[model samples]
Target: MRLRGRKGIRETIESQHDLVVLNPAEWKGRWAERFGNEKPIHVELGMGKGKFISEMSVLHPDCNFIGVDMYDELIRRASEKARAAAGREDGSAPDNLALALFNIERIADVFDEGELRRIYLNFSDPWPKKRHARRRLTHAGFVRQYVRLLDSRGEIHFKTDSRPLFEFSLNSFADLNIRLRRISLDLHKDGPAPDNVMTEYESKFYEQQMPIYRLEAVIGQEALAEHEASLALAERQP
Candidate 1:
């Protein structure tokens, strides 16, 4: 759900410098230093409105969280939510969370190799058209970027209410021979796992009794080799 252009969206986002990262690329390889800690980092790509990441930051103070969205309006809203989650009325962000405006295609420029422990893709755009498949978050190209950013023990946690997208993502991972675990075709079949955090879209779908599909793709040695090979093949293409 893309929001309409709010009147001072850009100004609003710029004002929250403490919570929003204005230039993410400059902090590449130094995210832990940005947070002033050495805790593991988890990032949520395309974090719409930020209900999930905000809650996750509050729930797990031991890990640092970065919420990335391309829209200034969405980032602004997410910043307010983060502040509220931290119970700070003085506009300070949570110690463990940072929001950034980023285009996912250039994600590699913002994080160094093995910088992330986990990546979240919650209810991402399905991009139903065949020609647009490459734009999907779970596409092989994006997965390759994720593999580079994630450490050996890293994981990609993806949740979606769109069955077609779920199927596409599963097949994409399979083509790379990536290891997957905790796959649930109907994630809320037993009524919301205690450990599950719901995004705004997810909560709406859950209320309407929609089935959510989820999977965790683990980064293993085989996947690493495959990603490296793909990168080499791309380098040789032209």
Candidate 2:
């Protein structure tokens, strides 16, 4: 399905200027100041339509949330939904939520070292073609970048309906010696917990009785160093 082109998306975003930051690069390394608090920051990459992250800001008031997506239209849609959800009865979005428009590959440019406490990847694009393996968000290179942006004990929580993508991500994390925990192959069948906030896609997939794979991975210093060393060694090889 093609996305509906949003007219005046720029104006729409500007209207919710506090809720959406159009130029994420300018705020790099100083996101905490922008949030006006020292609260732990969490981000959701590919946060389609903003369901998960918006609800997250409401649920965890102490933690700031940033939802990143590449498309202007998607960000516009997400901005509206999130503002509506976070708004007071009179109409005001939460101070803890913000949305960024940028490709995930430039994530490092938007966040500095150890600036994030958690990262969420929900129903991300599978990028199934073998030739596009490197483009998958869970690819080694991306994982390495995530590790750099996360503080000690920070974790990445991932969920997907694609078996191949889930399996590939599992292997990718293992190869980096990252610690994996709380894995579930059929999330809905296992039953939703109070803490399980479903995204728009997650809800639809659950209604369709499709299995959802989920896991939490921790990238400790040792694991990150090991992965970097391996990459270095591979680079020096003929």
Candidate 3:
């Protein structure tokens, strides 16, 4: 999946920053300070190819965004976009964006309990095979990690085109009893709800006339929900 014309500025710095990061904890605690602001934190997990998040940092200057992905090559592109935005160059993007190379399973180690204000899962792999259910981002294993990083009633926003994955996610959320805040079986026909923000994958899907399923789940008053715990971060964003 080689993208043409993506090497904007990270081309120069990517060699300097060691694009691949094994642990997110390095940048976890002071992620806020990374932007020189103590503002609210919102994260987008699986920021493929880097589009939605770079635009978000431009649109919302108040909130600091953290984009996490495991792939070093993809992260390099994201870093380029962030650097461009920060410098306000011709092909550069908006500032206030931080990219991290993190295993989503290590979310807790990246942020303390009740630290993050929100989480976004855009077009995550369904892992539809029964044996691979544990790999799904919305599965109990990942949900547990989210609870630790999430602030009280912190929300997890998700969107996907996979029906099986969406259904599985719904049942998993209820089984955990974290609280399903909003469930839209088909987001496009939801009668003018909140305007949907387009992610890179999302935009492609729409052009192909694909319908996206979406939902938002939140943490409840329960101290603990039906889920496991987390593993672990260092720093150096994607």
Candidate 4:
């Protein structure tokens, strides 16, 4: 599904080149140097319209954030809001933020192993078919990729409105032996968390009284070793 062709999305995103990296692969393993800081890097995979990442960068100047989405049109919209938020006449984003357009499957090519401190999966697509289970963002294969990309203490924060997907993800994490924390079955039953940054989809779901499920999972040394062993065992199955 392509976004309506905005007259100049390419130019708009390019004008914000300082904030949006059209070729993120060039900065792989050197993203911190590009940011000119050793601050921990956090990325929101599938960032739609950039609401959360833009607000988060403003709130936490000490940390660097990069929002990754495959869509350029959405990135253009995000760039506009980011530039406006920073009050920049030019289309640059906040100093602590960046945006990237890249294939999520090739995420490793854009970031080295252990280069990231945290990854956010906000309202990711739920590939509901049983055969498509591996395509789910929280599937064991993707979880393993995230494990390789994140530091030992790194965590993945996932939020979704789909109960079936959420339940499947919970099992996936357990199967991968990832440590789970901060489980919330209904994130907005009371109110948004103090530091909660809502995505565009989240806002719409909230208005419909949908229960949002969230959890934080981490892959430490033990978990990674277990993951590796599982892969080895799977190879031996044949």
Clashes of 4: 0
**Model 4, CA-based lDDT:** 0.87
Cα deviation at 193, candidate 4, in Å, is: 2.5
Query: Total clashing residue pairs per candidate?
Result: 0, 0, 15, 0
Model 2, C-alpha of 136: deviation from truth (Å): 0.7
Candidate 3 lDDT tens digits, 132-216: 9999999988988887788754778888999999989998888888666457776766343465668877777777767889888
Q: TM-score for each prediction?
A: 0.90, 0.90, 0.79, 0.89
Residues 115-187, candidate 1, lDDT per residue (tens digit)? 9999999999999999999999999999999999998768899999999999999999999998787899988
Candidate 4, residues 1-238, lDDT tens digits: the string is: 5679578788877877588899999999999998999999999998888898888888899999999999899888887777777776764579998999987988889999999989999999998889998879999888998998888658899999999999999999999877777799999998776689888889998888889999988666654576567779989996
Q: Which candidate gets the maximum TM-score versus the true structure?
A: 1
Screening candidate 4 with a backbone cut-off below 3 angstroms (N, C-alpha, C), the clashing residue pairs are none
lDDT of each: 0.91, 0.88, 0.73, 0.87
Q: What value does the lDDT take at residue 12 in candidate 4? A: 73
lDDT computed for candidate 3: 0.73
RMSD of each: 8.1, 7.7, 9.5, 7.7
Model 2 sits at a Cα RMSD from the real structure of 7.7
Candidate ranking (lDDT, best to worst)? 1, 2, 4, 3
Candidate 1 vs candidate 2, TM-score winner? 1
